[model samples]
Structures are given as structure tokens and as C-alpha cells.
Target chain A: MNQTAMAENKAITISFPEELSEVQEMVRACIQCGTCSGSCPNEFAMDFTPRRLWRMVLMGQKDDIFKSKTFSLCSSCYYCTLRCPRGLPLTEAMAALKQIAAKDGLSKYKQSSLFYKSFLESVRRHGKVREMEFMTMYFTAMKSPFLPFRFAALGMRLMGKGKVHIQIPSKGEGKLKAIFRKVEEMEGR
Target chain B: MNYLYYPGCSLEGSALEYNLSTIAFMEAMGIELTEIEDWTCCGASAAESVSHLLSLALPARNLALAETMELDADLMIPCSACYLNLRNVAEKIKKEPDILNEINTVLKEDNLELKGDIQVRHLLDVVATDLGADSLAPKIRKSLDGLSIAPYYGCQCLRPYTVFDDPEKPTTMEPLINVTGARVHAWDMGGKCCGASHMNTKMDVGMELVAAILRAARGADAVVTVCPMCQMNLEAYQKKISATYGEDLSMTILYLPQLIGLAIGLSDKDLRLDLNLSITESFRNKLNNDCVK
Candidate 1:
């Protein structure tokens, strides 16, 4: 551990990343309502609940907050955000946390990260998601030899029905490249 | 009435049935929907986690393109994710001009700009409000009599920013379903989450959430939903979720437009009911049968 960082951790006021300063200020409204945690559809599997995570934010546990899988597993359902009694924009905060997790390389959900990367790969290639090819890439990338076959029967069924497409098609939106490139340069990712 | 339809990525690919039924429903009502030319993915749940700017810019780019075209009608999105992404653009631009300017500065390189004045609407909003019940009543060619169904309005359609209908306890789709004579089964879990991207991220948990919805909708003929992701999750994961939950959860998940299209006399080829995963035999028979006078 870096001596300065460890020392700063012991101090009463610790420094946070520039973006988190805003979050840190807004989360002060949290009353530990537990409504968000209760309402989250996937909270049953979380290592730390959203309520606890909000508490951590209040406590300035920046390292723990970044490393936690709480936000990475959000799924962007916006249930908690909509149902929050405090009207905290909880989902937006989770999205911001996801960005922080991505930028800092702090995501604990490898599968989640893998899936997002695969989705982005498809979008970059054709500007649309070819589900069959995306799943193939995802299982192959994750080194799961059995998963694709497991999904094959269902995939074929969907393909037969024209639900799961077998062909790769592009929207031919060349301007998308410019938009993506600009965002990449802006985000420095 | 005319509208610029944004089908998004999933609609063109995995959720093609949603696209089919929405078009059929729109067509039957004599509403013209012109697809936004060269529209790309909204970046959905993926971009928001990867880069905030990417999330905003991806959808904003589509809006920018729509602006450049000088489209005649308000943009209408059938997919909940696309609707949320497109509808939020104007609000985002107005709420954060610095970020808007920053994104605009980036977009200036492409000879495009993200304008905040563009009106974005969801397909449900157009059907329920613009078309109205009276306008739709006479159009019903086939009656959905004795066909029991539950309306599943999953996340993103009415939340984060509810453009149409009440955020909680949405009954907007009730009258639309009622007009078809299909019984609208009132359930408490209507506006709940469908474990969204978790299907790809966390499979087991996703199945559990789907199982809960299935259990909640046990006796109904099908769970009629507006979101493609929700439909996909509830249907595609049936076997796995049934196995996981130790129950035979053979629940039929339907697109809202599919239900509407069928009730309004659209054919199987038109709405593409064959694309549905967990098919209900009764639903099919009724769909294929001639409209009851």
C-alpha cells in the first residue's frame, strides 16, 4: 500500500476523485431507508446492499465503494431509483459508480464486464447486436466451451422463428464511428 | 398521424417480433411510422457503465441525425430502453448545458448537433393517448373474448422519467387491452424490474427474478409486456428458470403490440406470433380464428 494513501485514510477528511465530490454531497440525504436495497430485484446476491453502499459513501469509504460489486450488478432496472422515498436518483448514482468502477478497473463482476465488452464489440462492428454472434463471442471469450452448445437448441429455435438472427447485419451508419471515437477520446478509455 | 420510429438495435435483431407487431398495430390504426434513417444502437445498459459520455452521445447522435433530417413527426420508440435513451435527451441537454456543449463540441467534427427541442414519444404513449380508446374501438376486427392476460409494464418504460401514464400502478394499457375483450388481470408486480441486463451478466439471479414474475402470473394466458428485454427474459429463460425454481414455469411472454395487433385482426404473418418463445396454444388458436362478429 502507498504510504501517503494509507496515511490519508487515517485522516478525518480524505480526498475523493473529482467526480465523486458531487455524489458525496448528494448522498447526504440518504436516511438509510433500505427501500432501494429492498426494492432491488437482484439484491439477494449482492455482497453489499445499496443502502450499505450509500452508508459507505457517507463514510467516505471511497476504495471500498469503488471495489464493491453493488453497482456493477445493478442491471439498470431503475426500480430502486423510481421507488426511492428520498427521490435520490439512485440509479443515476449507480451508473456513475459503474463508470468509476470501469475507469478504476475495480469491477468485481467479471461476467458482467465481459458481457458489456461483448455488447460493445458488436455495436462497434455493425452498430447492431447480432445475438447469435454476440453469444458465440461471449461464451468463446469467457472460455466456456459448453455454454454455447447449451444455448444452441434455444438459439436454433429462435433462429427458426426469426427471433435470434444468424446473419450479421449493419445499420451502415458511418457517423456512428465519429460519435464513438469522440466519446472514446473524451472519456480517455 | 405520422411519427419517426426508432426501433433500436434489439428490435432489428433479437426482438424482431416486437418490430413486426408494432408495425402491424401502427399500420392497422392507419398511423404512418417512418423509421429514422441510419439509426444506430442506443448503447443501452452497456454504455452507461463503460462511459457516461458514450451513453449520452450514442443516443444523442441518433437525435442529432433526426434533427439534421428535419423529420416531420415526433420520434416514437417501441423499445423501452430506446425510449428512455431517446426521451431523456432533451432533459439531459437542458439540465446540463456544459455537458451538452462538451458533447456538441465533439459532435461538431461530424457536422452534426444534438438539439434539445426534439419531441421523443414511446409507442405505448401514442397508442393510449394519441390514438385514444374511441378511435381504436371501431378498429377491432377480432375480439380477444375469454382470453385472460396480464399486462407486464417492466422497467424503463415508465420510470427514471415517466413521459406517459402514472409512474406507479399504470392502468394506461388496461383500456387498450379491454377494447380487445381480453381480460386485463390486475397484478401488483406490473411495474417491477425484469432482472434486465442481469440475464447476460448474472444468469441464475435473472432466472430467479423471472420465476417470481411467472409465479405471480401463474394462471394468466400470457404476460403482455412492452419492453423487449423483459419479454426475452420472461420467455427465453423459462426452462432454466423452471429447473432452478423446481416448478414448471411455462409462461407465455407477449409484446403489448402483439396483443393489440391480434385483437385488431392482424394475421400471424403480420404480427409474427411464431417468433414468441413460450407460445400459448389457446392464444394462437384465437389469433388464427376469424374475428367473431
Candidate 2:
């Protein structure tokens, strides 16, 4: 076999990480029917259609898979999962892919991952999301000075409607601290 | 009837109208709600992306707290995302004892355990199944007679679980809308995705999806939603989405309970209708002229 053929063979046999074993198992059942992609509301925005991503998953194109924003673009509507002819848990697989990206600390997903982290951090602190505080944290962590301005009009509208509550940061009641702490320790993060 | 209520974060903040209207509507229906003490966030759609276990554990913590209440009643969640998260935990633990044990090991940090005993239900499920349209009809003091409402179920409430309503062709809300004397707007976007958190993460995509739903709901006076994320996406972005799409995609977006509150003769203050973002002047006039007692 020539070098190019050998490389193609190697690509075809690449292994997915253990974190995605469940997704791997489920995606293997996909018939490439495109039902998931067809059902996806965000398919147009995805770098790769969900069907194409599933095909890549089968082919173990891990690098190409992570390079695309397909999974992160999943809004978790579960329409794909619902419409999957094989009942493949497509949404959960998408979520598992997100989990892998998050666990790997992939820079490609930094913005979105940071958003989720900021959200959970707020929840961990207050036992609930303080909207203004959460957004503030996310914007600050994002280090994007223009980000808050983008939401300024909407934020003002929400505040005008009494939807956004401004709270001075203080020690939270620590309602979920123990749970968060234990999970962090267990997850070995 | 009673329930252990889990008003997730958005209900307290952005979706306060959902909370207020829910309380008033449920109370008027002769149902009592006992709020779960120290009920934390149910991780929404973000948690599972970060940690699958944290997602389950966060909701499981709330479930454990509900179990401690000893209510023997199903835990009712108003937010669809919260409902899905908590319901996912409940369903997962029921199917896998090992998963339950793992979550319990984490919950032990909070001095809680996952027994998987309490049933988790969305408010829509409770309203449609437990308090059927027939039981609720007599409570109507003012008829929303001519107003056409698009019953937008969004995504979470009906999908992946299929608990009380058909995931694809949901008709439960139509009967409830009929009981209020409003016409159900004929549209197929009821079960569609409203871009959800992508409104924050990926604005273009979210805007496009929101524009589609809003455009599809043009003939209706208002779009009735059951999810906070959906309500916010549909209500808050109308002006921008309209501008981007070069169409007048303006419509009143409100909670299902708020609509019911109006039918039941609850005050606007009771329903927090003023807090809703995109309630048009025409919609207000219609409600005031026809639905007000």
C-alpha cells in the first residue's frame, strides 16, 4: 500500500475517546438517514450537518469533528433525538460531544464553554442564577469589552420591566456549595 | 390538589411573570403549591454540556430537596428546560440504579440522597392532565372570545419524554385555549425550536429561528409560551429580528398561565402582564375591551 492509502486507512480506523463511548455506541446505529440533520433547527448554521457529523463519528475523524461547531450549535431541542429513526439519542450524543470538548478544554469552544461555566458558577454560588450577575460574570470572563454593550439595550429593557434584579455581590447562602465541591472532587477537576 | 413547586432561576428573574401568573392561576384553580426550600438551579441546558454528572446532580439535588418535603406529590416545574433537566435525572435514576447511586454519593455532600420516588412533571402536564380543560372551564370569569393565540410549546415540554402530550402533534394546549374561549391559531411552529440559549451564544442562528417562529405567528394576536427561554427569545428580540428579516414580526408573547389568568379574571398585576416585553398596544386594547370584566 502507498503512503496516502495507508494514511487514509489510519484515518478510517482512528479511535474516539472513552468519554464518548456512549455517543459512539449510539451513533453506530445511525443509518445516515439525515433525519437528525433534517430535524435540526440550527442545521443551516452548523459547520457540518448533524448527519455529516455522525458519518464522521463513525469514521473516527475526531479532529475534524471537534473542528466543526456542529455539537456546540445544538440547542438541545431534542427534535433530532425524537425524529431519529433508530432512536439513537442524538441530542444526548451531541451533549456528550460537548462534554468531551468541555473536558478537553478545547480553545475552539472557549466562548460557549465559558458561557456554560459562568452560568454554572453563578448557580453554584447563589443556588440560582442572578441574571445580571451571571451576565456580568460571563462578559467579564470573556474579556470582550464590546460584549456587554451588545446586550445593553436588552438589559435596559429587562431592567425597565423589573426583570433584571441588581444584587451587590456578597457571600451566597452556599446552598449548593457542598454538592458542587463534591462533584468537582469526584470529577477530578 | 397540591404540588412541590420548583421555580427555576429564570422564573425568579427574567420570567417572574411566569412565576406570578402560575401562582395566581394555580391558586385560583384550587391547587396549592409548596415551594421546595433552597431549590437551586436545575442546570438548564448548560450544565450537561460541561459535566453530565453535574447536570444530573444539580437537578437531583433539587429532587432530593423535594423528597425531603415529604409531600407525596409530584414536583411541578414551570420552566421547560428545568423540567427536562429534572425529569431527565428522575428518568435516568429510575432506569439505572448505579447512576442513582453515583448521584446519591454526590448528593451526600448536601446531606441528601436520590430515592427516585417523586415524579417530576411540567406545569403544562399538571394543567392538561391533572386539571383538565373541563375542570378549568367553570373558573373562567372573562372570555377571551375573539383573540387568536398561537400555542407555542417550544421544544422541551413535549419532546424526548412524551409524558403527557404527543411530541410531534401536541393538541393539549388547544383544548385549554378553547376553554378560555380563544381561537387556537393554525400554525405548525408549536413544537419548533426557538434557538434557545443560542440567542446568547450564536446570535445569527437564534435570530433566524426566532424570526421564523414570529413570522409564522403573524395571524395570531399573541404567542402563548410555556418556557422562559422561549418566551424571552420570542418576546425580547422582535424588533431586531424584524429589522434583520425586513418584516414586521411583532407579536405579544406571554406565558400560558398569564393567558389563563386573564380568562379567570385575575388582575394584570396578579399575572404580571406588564412585565411581558412584546405585548402590543392592540393586544392590550383587545384584552381590555373584551377580556376585562
Most DockQ-accurate candidate? 2
Candidate 1 lDDT, tens digit per residue, A35-139?
999988878888899999999987878767765678777877777888888888788888877766566544364566677767777786777766776776788
Candidate of highest TM-score: 2
Candidate 2 regions with alpha-carbon error over 4 angstroms: A1-16, A168-173, B290-293
Compared with the true structure, the alpha-carbon lDDT of candidate 1 equals 0.78
True contacts kept of each: 0.79, 0.92
Model 2 clash pairs are none
Chain A vs. true chain A, TM-score per model, equals: 0.76, 0.86
Q: How many clashes show up per model?
A: 0, 0
DockQ values for all predictions? 0.62, 0.76
lDDT per prediction?
0.78, 0.88
